[model samples]
Target chain A: AQSVTQLDSQVPVFEEAPVELRCNYSSSVSVYLFWYVQYPNQGLQLLLKYLSGSTLVESINGFEAEFNKSQTSFHLRKPSVHISDTAEYFCAVSDARGGGSNYKLTFGKGTLLTVNP
Target chain B: DAGVTQSPTHLIKTRGQQVTLRCSPKSGHDTVSWYQQALGQGPQFIFQYYEEEERQRGNFPDRFSGHQFPNYSSELNVNALLLGDSALYLCASSLGGSGNTIYFGEGSWLTVV
Candidate 1:
């Protein structure tokens, strides 16, 4: 079984300030990490993912997450925040079992990020 | 191209009743997965369908069932629903392969009363 832990349940930040959302995971096998954001009354949107080759992955919207194997962490970071960035963020992991089950994402409880102007 | 889409944006059901939610995968995608996101919780995988077959399942009980048609559209059915069954049902689609990016629909809100 694989599990993801998002350390914070809610994060408040002022616009243009830096923010980080911490996530940690436990898995028996190699894992793929992902970050998903959900706005109010909407579904999840993939922000970025870490499959291979690089430990750091970035999203088009200026968010980035670094996958740390030693610490079992995949913390998301953004240098500046915007009110539009306010949303609930989730951390997910899938084992390297591959095949049909590779898409079975195990998600974290989610962290609600509220950006203030 | 259209992304994943789900029907019955919101609905209310009584205990012991049955509910069926539908989904249409993104264009050209062949695999579909169902997830249940309870209030204030992360979405939990319910099952996945590929090639019109149940390719994988999660820890959910048999009360939660699903089907995929030749067109790659799918339905999620829950029988004998309980208050705990209230959740946001999410449908995700992706090509049947490892590392392929999966896309999610806006989701159907189910309120069990």
Candidate 2:
């Protein structure tokens, strides 16, 4: 079984400021980590994922996350956030042993990021 | 390409009643999964369907069920619903195999009274 914990329930930052959403996971086996963003009245959109490769993965929208194995953390960060970046961010994990896509994902409670101008 | 799509954007039902939600997987995808998102919480996996059969399921009870069609579309049926069942139901689709990305729909909002 896998579980995710988001350290913060809400984060408020001014536009152009940096922000980070903390996430930690507990799993008996290796896992795939993902960050998903849900805008108002919209579905969850994949922001970035850490399947395998470098410990750091970046999204097209300037968001990035680093997978820290020792700390069991995958924290999402952005240097300069825009008002459009305000959304609910969720951290999810799936068992690496599942061996394929469409595997079950365990998600955190979620962190609401509000970017103020 | 059309992304995962779900039907009945929002619906209201009473306790002990049953409700059915539908989903159309993304184009060229053969796998569909269902999730439930409660207020102020993240989505929880309900089940996954492949090839018209259920392949994986989560910790949910048997009252929650689903079916996959030949066209890769799916339907989620919840029986004897309780107020706790009021939540957003999401449908996701992905190709059946390794290295595929799963996509989600906007979700259907179900309110149980």
User: Best DockQ goes to which candidate?
Assistant: 2
lDDT of 1 by residue, A5-112 (tens): 999999999999999999999998988999999999999999999888889899999999999999999999999999999999999998766542357999999999
Error of 2 at A92 (Å): 0.2
Give the DockQ-based CAPRI class for model 1.
medium
**Stretches of model 2 off by over 4 angstroms after superposition:** none
In Å, residue A95's CA in model 1 sits off its true spot by 1.2
Model 2, A1-117: lDDT tens digits are 999999999999999999999999999899999999999888899989988889999999999999999999999999999999999999999888766435878999999999999
lDDT of 2 by residue, B13-105 (tens): 999999999999899999999999999999999999989999899999999999999999999999999999999999999997765778999
Which parts of model 1 have CA positions greater than 4 angstroms off?
A99-102
Interface C-alpha RMSD after superposing true interface residues, each candidate, one decimal: 1.8, 1.3
lDDT over C-alpha atoms for residue A104 of model 2? 78
Clashes of each: 0, 0
Q: What DockQ class does candidate 2 belong to?
A: medium
TM of each candidate vs. truth: 0.98, 0.98
